[model samples]
Target: MRRYGQAVLMLLVGAAVLRISLFSALYLRYVQSGLRPYLIASGALLVLLGVAAGVRAAREVPDEDETQDPHEHGHTHTTGPRLAWLLALPAAALLLFPPPALGSYSADREDAQRAAQGIGTFPPLPSGDPVDLSVAAFTSRAVYDSDRSLKGRTVRLTGFVTHGDDGTWYITRLLVSCCAADATTSKVEVRGADAPATDTWVTATGIWHPKGRLGSSAAWPPLLDAKAVRRVEEPSNPYEQR
Candidate 1:
């Protein structure tokens, strides 16, 4: 049972990995697209192993009844490891119910305590009304740019809302390198009106207030004086790629 089950579990795992990697959006929630090739390769290998195991099981002769007849013309068949079936749980879960990406809850937990990097000059912005910017990019400009680069522009930032104990609301977005495990969040204080429910996806159009102390790695983030807040559905890809 154990050995045969191992092969079957491997096959299922491989198929699930390939299915999510190739045909579904599930993998995008956990890791970047760069992992697709590796996932496909792993799935193929597992399937091959399972096929080999099945072939071996089929070719074996039947076992004799030990108690009834030792001299009887019969053979014994080997069963795979009995406990190897446990390995199927993860694969089954992933196949049936792939989880969503980290969101407001995850963002709320990760403080901006990451070691500072690339904290120098920022380039001028191209002309536009309500200039579009990612949450992370806006945070970087607000915190590190000494020139107040976001002074006049009405920037549009989209993220889920997170409520702070101090009665403030934040436009929060998680930045992930390759997966959620290493994700960090960039948050901006939302001012000008009452904040919506926590974890609500919103597009906050606002002007930068320069409220937080800038040019230093202070825990406080820059504030956005929100002129308009529109509730929106969560985006297909939740994490901001860093």
Candidate 2:
């Protein structure tokens, strides 16, 4: 039972790694920004514990007089062989078929929200080169005012789709603090084009135009000129890439 437990735990760890690697949003929140260092530290601790458990299990052996049947004792007392095979379950899952990215399923999940205090006002760009702004920035500004400063500026954002209302499509980028357990959602309402498939990664280059009012929430009223739009693979570290 101990061996089985260890095996199951190891498999869970492997699945987590697979999910984080393949899914960009998960990678950004949990592995990139805030919780990255802690995850590394925790990973090291887990490795040490696994090693200690393995060593102790290895040293444990049944006495000759303890069992009447040699075969039963042989199978029950040996730990390495039993636990070693369990690793293959995760390995096979990874190799044979990996999970897909977080898709439109989480569109309505309201994990994305901006910080009220720390997120300062959007600064004016030099207006020389194309300005780079995150979806978080746009969402923050939309809460306070619905101005056109963000209009006609080239903006870059990556996230999954949340929903579409009227002619606008709502997209979201998830910010994870630790594991998927503590993920927050930041959203952008895109206009001037038909909504892309929900939960797919996209780079939208457009001019920001303030449109209608959101709910009792802040006013985000911004539209993308949508000069260009294309789908891309989710990056290894999918958050702001900061």
Candidate 3:
């Protein structure tokens, strides 16, 4: 712990970063895609620094003139190094078992913070049946669009499932402006379909079930009358960009 503790910690952290950002798409769980280059660079630099430190430590020699007294040697000052090793635990976890993207727990926490967006007119959606749309896009249109853009349209939305307090289920995706810390939930109430397991990714094809006037609270957590629901693999990037 004394000789190479810092080096080992740095290597562990750098390897963790590389595991998530450079070697795979797991970084998407924590940050926006645009930050990948920065993360990769930072991870590479840490690895290089760790390697250099290890080499320097390996070539070091104990100071013969600065011998410790036997009384002090038996009660050494190893506490700091021991505590420092604790920092490596999270890094090791990240490298071995990266965490999943934000899910129902995060979504539920946003219940009180879901602000109502101002109403506006949106551009007409592309002409097609069962048009694919992100959960955030669909939610915005269903709640705020003055023209009721989602009316009469068969849209497909994909997200993990989250249960409500009243036994209802939603297709929910987190919306991130930068990273998971600032992520907001975008969910749609699904009717006419049985819910999959919580946190299970799924694609729902449905038409908007209008509840109230646009720009009103009653219109939110926009309703979807699902015609079909199919289980799907979670996307590499689970969050919708804001």
Best by TM-score: 3
- Alpha-carbon runs more than 4 Å astray in model 3: 63-75, 112-116
Sort the candidates on lDDT, descending order: 3, 1, 2
Number of the top-ranking candidate, with lDDT as the measure:
3
- In candidate 2, what are the lDDT values of residues 36-75, reduced to their tens digit? 5555455456556656666665677744544356476555
Compared with the true structure, what per-residue lDDT tens digits does model 3 show for residues 1-242?
A: 35787898889999999999999999999999999999999999999999999988878884542356536656555476679889989999999999888899999888733345688899999999999999999988988888988889999999999998798999999999999999998999999999899999999999999987777777778999999999999999999999
> What is the C-alpha local distance difference test score of each model?
0.80, 0.56, 0.89
lDDT of 2 at 218: 41
What lDDT is reached at residue 6 by model 3?
Answer: 81
TM-score of 3: 0.94
- Shift in Å, residue 80, candidate 2: 20
Q: Estimate, for each residue in 11-124, the C-alpha lDDT of model 1 and write its tens digit.
A: 789888877887776677888778878877888888898888877866766443424454454654333343456678888888888777787778777766633654566898
- Of candidates 3 and 2, the better by TM-score: 3
Return the TM-score for each candidate structure: 0.84, 0.62, 0.94
lDDT of the structure predicted as candidate 1: 0.80
**Worst 10-residue lDDT window, candidate 2:** 111-120
